[model samples]
Target chain A: MSETTILRTEQLKKSYEKGKYILNNFTFSIQKGEVVVIVGPSGCGKSTFLRCLNLLEPIDSGSIYLEEQLISAKDKNASKIREKIGMVFQSYDLFPHKTILDNLLLAPVKVQKRNKKEVEQEAEELNKKKIELDLEFRKEEFLSKTTIWWPETKGCNR
Target chain B: MRDMGISVLFQGNNFVRLLIGLLASLRIAAIAMALSVVFGVLVGMMMRSKHGWIRFLCRCYLEVVRIMPQLVLLFLVYFGAAKHLGIDMSGEVAAILVFTFWGAAEMGDLVRSSLISIPKHQYDSGYALGLTKWQVTVHIIIPQTVKRLLPSGVNLLTRMIKTTSLVVLIGVVEVVKVGKQIIDASRYTVPTSALWVYGAIFLLYFIICYPFSKLATSLERHRKEESV
Candidate 1:
């Protein structure tokens, strides 16, 4: 893999039980600015593989590298690594209890410890784009705001 | 001032004694309910643990509390412990301990079910934002859980208050015990005083328990409408 490969997993092995390998020797790498989709039949380890990429699932045998840094190590800081890799779900469910602005502000302000005023001001620019996007979108929460907020997060746009 | 047995209820300090006894019952129930919420939330969170031993321990605790009656738990803590372990604990303390054990178990189950009622993706969404486990729990998960859990908690408090009547058997000077004392004292002069005093005790319990149930139902309705 080239140095620009942001996420790489080598010889990945995972199983729910011994000798029943769901993911066996799955070596894959994605380069920067590449949008690659992995499609397969159900229970073909697609979701599990995606989960393992973000450290949500642990690999039984193999290694995961994010920008050539070993993030799959047991002792590495998971939150720090996960901050650099954002995963959106199929449902697009934002925190329903919070307002749209609060949902956008949560990671940047709380996780990154950034200045609220600066973050709010930065987000205001996105709000204009969001308004334009909303004109074509259905009036549903799942699709409306979360799509706009996705770009504000780092590494997600990569 | 008629010599009938009904007058035996409100005569002099007899009324004061009933009020004091009711306060004692409320005190114990309130304390136990508070402790239950604190410990119950902890147990509920722990029930979702991935470790085998922790989940096993939580399951065993819940089953034991379910199979064994709350009164039996009280006796084990109060009389049995005093007899065998020489703990010499007081009735109120024992009642609090037993009630908290039972209440926490019930409340923990309530919390667990309410937690599961939320969609599974919310946790994944929070964690994917690079928020720590505790951050997602405290900031994202628990606020929603508390909003859903409150009505059931208020309902549980009323049940706890009614069950506090059981503590009188352990020799606590609760409302019913004092009512029994009043009836026994007037037994000779007013032979039918047991009916009046016991009736008065029932009225006191009704007055305390009814409003709580009304509030719970109203809150429950609001919760249902909002959840949609």
Candidate 2:
């Protein structure tokens, strides 16, 4: 089976001020169900690139396509396009006023207008399974704990 | 019995007059504050408008109110408007109009600054969650802005209450005006009537304003604790 390209950006260009491009001629394509990591030094446009993908920051010039649809066009609905993309921030920006469950269900329930009861049930089941796995991993790690002799600590002056 | 300055408050119908006057002040302040807050929030939202002309217009209004004295504004509305524009505005109406204008400007500035102070990440996060701009503003931005706006709003209310004394100068017989009346009436009979009457007026203002000041302080402290 051939892999499908989910997202494709062509000759992307973005600048804060005139003639100063943060994302100059950037081009990339991501396949469906494939993990792509963006790594770069400080001041690089990693975050800006991600923001531009969702139209959080407007690109100066480029074409971004989600599958076959041209999403970066002027009249394209950014909010609807953003609904299909899920992003996790380095610093968790969860709504402080909402509970963890509500935070998880907010977009699905409110934006997608999904059935609340169904989403809630699924989320609860997922949370329970995650907690169970975490506990089992902790137990295994504890059971496999071993003591290592430190010859250097004993020989060195205290 | 000549130096009955403060004691004139207890004189015949003087106490009742002062109470009525204070009630009048409270009534005007309450109505003006409510209108100010409603109009102020609208103006504040306008100040953050994407349109440069809208922002410029709002900024001009804000600067005029903030730079000019409240007394001057009161005079402008009461004397200038009535004389030049041929509008028959009562003293109370003029006072309410001027204060609303002034208070709205102050409140608008407060709302603008508080809304601006919220981190950019909040909007980004809300957008990333697929919330529309209006939905993000209504659900996420407004709640936080309200929390931050409370202390300053309370402070502005208190300031408006205190500033209501300026209405007396415009011939509105509010608390200070009544106090002046009492002093004038007792000037010949009582030697220190002015002191007592003015002291009572001062106490009336302090009584009205002190609680609001305390409320503002507590609100600010509570916000700090929550943030920490």
Candidate 3:
């Protein structure tokens, strides 16, 4: 209930079959700038938990909050809440027909209704950063500590 | 009185006719394939959607497509819909509509399977990296699916090309129809010419489809090796 809570889930639960609770009464909260890892055994509901956070999986019962607004547990406004959250899969699910640059620019262009030139510029910037990170990795001393960091900075919201 | 030796392929007339027919078929297939690909990919994406009604609708469409044969689909498109529309569509237009529908269904399924087959971890990692769902689909899912789906798409394209011959049944002046015309005209001296004409048709089909088949198989094999 803190003012800085970026995400909050209360009594979250999911079940694939009737009465078979894979995730049960999971209550958790994430602060605005914190990174929380949900580690569990194989076949546990870690992935489901992530999906539920974004409404990718409908919660069987309970509710989730993003910022000051309620995300799930409501029928009408779920999609609107989902717009604020972004998800990426473990696999490099880049579109084959489209180039790497196009992949980066798609959501921004289509969903965000951003200018093509701006999106293209951002993609180019990311590409440059990736190259720099790679070069840093090759250096003898800096290789150990080099990190590319997030692809996009938070404040650059367009 | 002696009968004049009238060779059927006097000079180069037959080749010109066949060439034109081949080009027309190619044009029709190309346009149909392009439109179908666009439609199929969109449908495929919808099928993989999380919403209940969307998924159900897509599944229903796929099942219907699977149950109905493509030839029947062509008949419905040419005879049924064309008549109802009262536009008096050309046979070629009817052929395009039939194949486009068929290709869209098949390609949609291809795209859906490819999209679903991607590992969950991929989506998670993309999320962990803070990319949006749309971003992940466009970036991570679609690229991998394209690599997987290209060969099958090419295969579909070839099938579409071969199937264009069915348009002949509806009176399209394709290679087969022209060949049939030649056979009917030269019913006397063209004894066994049907064999040659059909053989030529098969060769033309092979010429169009062979490279695509090779590309599909080779790309598939290459993907496997790369994965391994």
| Number of the predicted model whose lDDT against the real structure is largest | 1
Docking class of 3: incorrect
Measured with C-alpha atoms, the lDDT of residue B144 in candidate 3 is 83
lDDT (Cα, tens digit) per residue for candidate 3, span A2-57:
88998888888899898988889988888998866667776787767777876767
| lDDT tens digits by residue: candidate 1, A1-158 | 78799889999999888999999998989999887878788888777887788888878999999899888999988888888887766666678788877888999898889998888887788777777788766665546566666663432210
Tens digits of per-residue lDDT for model 2, A8-75: 89899999999999998888888886767777886688888888887888999989988867899999
Report the error of model 1 at residue B126, Å: 1.3
The per-residue C-alpha lDDT of model 3 at residue B31 equals: 91
* TM-score for candidate 2, residues paired by index: 0.86
Please write out the lDDT profile of model 2 over residues B1-228, one tens digit for every residue. 345456677889898999899999998999999999999999999999999999999999999998999999899899998899999889999999998999898999999999898888888878877789998898888988988999999999998998999999899989999988888888788868888878887888899899999999999999888777
Best candidate (score: TM-score): 1
Query: Residue B60, candidate 3: how far off, in angstroms?
Result: 4.0
> How would you order the candidates by TM-score, starting with the best?
1, 2, 3
Model 1 off-target regions past 4 Å? A1-3, A17-22, A134-141, A152-158, B1-5
Residue pairs that clash (backbone atoms under 3 angstroms), model 1: none
Model 2 steric clash total: 3
lDDT of 2 at B134: 91
TM-score of each: 0.88, 0.86, 0.67
